[model samples]
Target: MNTTDIIGTIGVSLILIAYFLNIFSLIKKDGNLFYILNIFGGAIACFSSYLIRFWPFVILEGTWAVISVVALLKSIKKPQD
Candidate 1:
C-alpha cells in the first residue's frame, strides 16, 4: 500500500521466485542466479526493514544477505572442471 510495503513485497517476491524455481527444478540451488536473487532480495528486504526501524528483520535479512554473499564466494572459488 505504502512505499515500505511495496519495497518489501518486491524483495520478498524475488526471494519466493527463486525458491519456487528451485523447487520446480527450473534453477539450480548452487547456481549463481539463485544466490544473486537471495543477495538482492535480502538486501532490499533489509533496507526496507531499516527504513521502518525494525531491528529484528534488519538483523535477520542482513544476516541472510551476508550469508548469501559468502555462499556465492565459495561457489565461485570452487575448482573448475
Candidate 2:
C-alpha cells in the first residue's frame, strides 16, 4: 500500500479501537487514553485527508482532532478523585 493509505489505515484503526473499547465498556469515554487516541488518530487522518485534497474528510477529521484536544485539556484540568 501507499504511504497515505497506510497512514489513513492506522489513523482509522486507532479511532475505531477507541470506539470499540468504549462500546465494550473496556475504557471510559472521558478517560485520557480515549482522548489521546482520538486526538492522534484524528490528526493523522486529517493530515492524510489534506494530502489527498479531500475537503470533506479534512474538515471532519480536523474538527474531530480539535474536539479531542479540547477534551484532553479539560481532562487534564480536572482534579483526580
Q: Which candidate gets the maximum lDDT versus the true structure?
A: 2
Could you tell me the lDDT of residue 80 within candidate 1? 77
Across 1-81, the per-residue lDDT of candidate 1 in tens digits comes to: 999999998888888988999999999999989999999999999999999999999999999889999999999999878
Candidate 2 per-residue C-alpha lDDT over 18-57 given as tens digits, one digit per residue, 9 for 90 to 100: 9999999999999999999999999999999999999999
Candidate 2 pairs with clashing backbones: none
The residue-level lDDT of candidate 1 at 49 comes to: 94
Error of 1 at 51 (Å): 0.6
lDDT values for all models: 0.93, 0.95
- Which lDDT value does model 1 have at 61? 90
Clashing pairs in 1: none
Candidate 1 ranges with C-alpha deviation above 4 Å: none
